[model samples]
Target: MEIFIVVLILLLSIVISNILSRLIPFVPVPLIQITFGIILGVLPTGIHMPLEPELFMVLFIAPLLYNDGKMTSREELWKIKSPVFLMSFGLVLATVLIVGYIIHFMIPDIPLSASFALAAILSPTDAVAVSSLSERIHLPEKIMTLLEGEALTNDASGLVAFKFAIAATVTGVFSFANAALSFFVIAVGGFLVGAVLALIIARLTAFIRRLGLEDATFHVLMQIISPFVIYLVSEELGLSGILAVVSGGIVYSLQSDYSEPIISKLKFVSRSTWSVLIFIINGLVFLILGLQIPDVMSVIFRDDTISNFKVLMYIVVISIVLILLRFIWVYSLWNEKWSVNESIEENPNRFLNSLLTSLAGVRGAITLAGAFSIPFYLENGQYFPQRDIIIFISAGVILLTIFIASFVLPLLVKNKNIEADKNSSKLNQQALKSVMNAAIRLINDETNQENKLAASSLINVCEKIKNDNPIDKEDIKLTIEDRKIEKDIFLLGIRAERKEVRRLLSDNKIPPATYEKIDNSLTKVENCLSKPPIIETLNRMDSIKNFISKFLKKQLNVNPINIKDIKKIKVLTSKAAIYAIKEQINDTNKKASLAVIDHYNDIIRRLTTFTIGEDINNVNKQRSKLHLKALQAERDQVQSLLQNNEINRETALKLRNFINYMEATAIEEQSF
Candidate 1:
């Protein structure tokens, strides 16, 4: 139970970090989570949860790497394959050899193999730490892609090195040939296993969907579970679980079928789930890292194993060595105008790009986790030499690298010139036209009066923006009036549609999965409605009240609320009072009926529109303007609910991401 509570605290650490990141943009998220985790570690209930090597590799590293592979464009990775693979494999191997020698030299008592293991632990550059660069900076696409690819693959390479190093340390012997052979088998076997698992899942999922058995709940659960399954299986097969997960994710991503609307909706849900899950995992990784450090500290300081000051010095020296070697290696590779992408001329500033790449090598949670997992005792039963010291030094290097990447990387980017995306404007224009075409199609195909009215209005608005055709003032007003009518009728349509879905479910015409998917959309729309039903009713009631008051003041010569009938209602058990109340009600009802009649009867000349729902636009502008705003509005509603703690984080992120994709579509449409 204490372990469970400690786990919850770590999860809370993730939440606290996100809120803190918003407050302190200068401090990176990893630091914030880690700092808070440290604070949590000091509490009375603080439970030490040390990571075991197998568990850390499976639970934390595998899924993260797999997701990284899934998100990364295979085409982009291929283009930068030479650089990325070299960095992932060759650079990792080189770092292990050099850092092993350096650490051994710094502390002669530490065995050479143990030093190599320490080096391997710190080899993988953290992708999560540098993820924001794509959103924050207009870095050369190729450079970012190369770095990301290295991040995805380097863990496997580092783990391979670590495996060999640990074996040498345990057995008191080393073999270059055996190490090389093991590395090849592990890497190759892991990839193949992942691919095979992914293919099986793809076929199974598609079959399930075809049979209409693929509920969004099930789809999302399977996706989240598959990485773990792949990892464990690969490990059982004497392969790298990290590589297996990565390959499975990438393969499954490519193999996925989201052709059906229901399937597509489920896919959206899964993506959103993954996004939020990733965020929490990222937070936990760093936060738990901070928690583990104190335990490492206890081990180091409990006995006079090494001077704390000397340990700090070793950390500083080792971190410097790692950074300098990577920078020198990357710098050496950038002589000519390297061509990765034809459209993106990223090689113009080769020197600067290399500098940025080198600086971006931030060590992260993986390093710390690996350090913690170092065995306390070797195979011979003697204590593992310098285990505590290795952990302390690794922690120091992680912090130093993160600080450099967070603080210094931005400054380097700031020095570079940023160019406007000329191509973006052209893309936006194309998107506007597509919306225009969609509008035209809607107008032409739909028999409904409201859709046509909204579509026509959208077309006119789009034409004016495009300078293609000018619409008359009368037509514009009528279109706007049509939209107002559509808003008024939208709820009625929603209720009716909901009734139909329920009816189908009761009659067994549709499967529960289908019902669920459709009903979920309906519920989301209902939850996200800007105005509640009662509010709309109250708005109408207010109008009715005002109309009655005006009529009484002008025609009956009395204030409506203060009239004799209304005043008599205050008398208890009076027949006249009851009669008066009835009269007041009748009068109010009459006025409301008259006002509603007037509202709908107002003739908008030469206008046609859908009253049930307004098509915000029939033109290209709809994508960027009206429809885009609607998507944002729905997401905003979800966000507000999430902020008020009305919905769970999982639900909030799922809804927000679905809306987000629509917004992205709009942005993309406009871009093209």
Candidate 2:
């Protein structure tokens, strides 16, 4: 019942925090939530929520850190690796030693062991908190990256140091050699375990994908299981779970092909879900911090046995010292030239940015959990020294930092506009568009010419036959000379059209849509022209006609014509061609129609390449006109052949009719 009530309150707080976040964008939501928690904690109802520090760390901190690590750009991380590592690991160790000593010496009432534990708990910065704050501010990417990276990496170091300190105190022994050796083994061993596990998981996932399983389910399961497995396994093996989780996250990210369709979809879903969870966790932690304020005050004030003023003074002093110590430590590194910026102002601002990174260090769940987890007493009945005082101080520092960092730091920095690297990106996009447009134009033009020539040849062959002559099938055959001439003319037209489209594309007059429509029509024509003309295969003729209709629909931007419409046109054309061929008709209509169809296809292709508003150069339009001339020449050849009886009149009529169909289709399609 207690657990359920706590959870309900946490949920309710999250809802309220989200609403408040929007209303007050300048103040962070976490800070607001923690303030709320502090208020709740002081209530007479005694609404205290207990969360085991270890469990909370694993469930919330681990995933949040893992995500921060993943999103950090690889190049930026590597560039600042030295400073990041130093700040996270070296500074954490320094903070523990320095602060622990100060607390012990300045306040004799606090035990050395307890001081060190408190210092250790406070050593590591919260990556989740830092990252959240960074996003809200206009901090430089490199600065944000350094802070987040340091926070993430230092948590493990700080935890390890804290454990060693605790062990030394409990066992009444301190050995530098053993502690150093243990740290080495735990860090190295945890990393190795995480790496191996990550590799194995990557391979297994790839295998699963190959087996044709649904990608969504597999990816979701991977997200749910990977972190826990890594942490638990490493800990069970007597290695650092923090190191293990970090190692696993890095290795898994490097190894996995997140570009795969399933993985991509899963990533989107996981990111959205994880973002909310982390927010609520941080919100609840902070809100609870706020709720504890009244209780903390009640304990100190009501219990006159303890000096409330002195305690408050000590907390203020320690918090100031902690904040100052960070600035001093950061300043010491100034002489080292850690970054490209040589100017003192620039370098220090970078350092300052890191210092103020996530000011809302509201020591929420972790501080509370760690403070509460203090060993009650030895069997001899000796009490822990200043345990409650340490808790109060830690909580105080968290509240102080959260408020100052979120509200104060923004005032310190000068505001400036920051823009993305747009010049390079713009150039790249333009280059890509140009190349694609060129390729499209080239293909469209060539196909168009081929269609026109085939039409002309068919018309010519039909005109050469006579209807009244004795049905001598051998005479019906198209002469080699005639076939060769037709093929040459068709090939020439295609070449001319290709050149013209290229010119128009260069000029930037033809729009992409215009090019696409013409290209599609040409593609259909090419397919039809590839096969020999066969009267029995009326379906093929239907297909060719359908292509023409589709081309027209595209040009006119009209609703698509159905297959039935295509079939009807094919039947009509095929019947006319057949009648002309059987009667040896002298119309030579087939040859003319074929030629026109070929020319029309070429024109459409050119139009598609010539981006209407784009090509100001007039190059593409001029080239298109040249190809049109070539088409005209072929049309004239078909006319000559028909007049000379090389094609019968019926065939000529059929060719003319086909040409009309091609013209109308191309015109309509081009309009679209």
- Runs off by more than 4 Å, candidate 2: 1-6, 44-46, 257-262, 288-298, 335-365, 379-381, 415-672
Q: Write the per-residue lDDT of candidate 1 for residues 43-152, one digit (tens) a residue.
A: 78775676675687678777777788787778878867888888999999999999889999999988999989999988998876666333333355567777788888
lDDT of 2 by residue, 334-452 (tens): 43334332211233444555355434232334555566566656334576667678777877777676667777756653231112222322322332233223323322333345344
Residue ranges of candidate 1 with Cα displaced over 4 Å: 1-4, 132-138, 257-262, 301-305, 335-347, 417-630, 633-672
**Candidate 1 at 338: error in angstroms?**
4.9
**TM-score of candidate 1 to 2 decimals:** 0.67
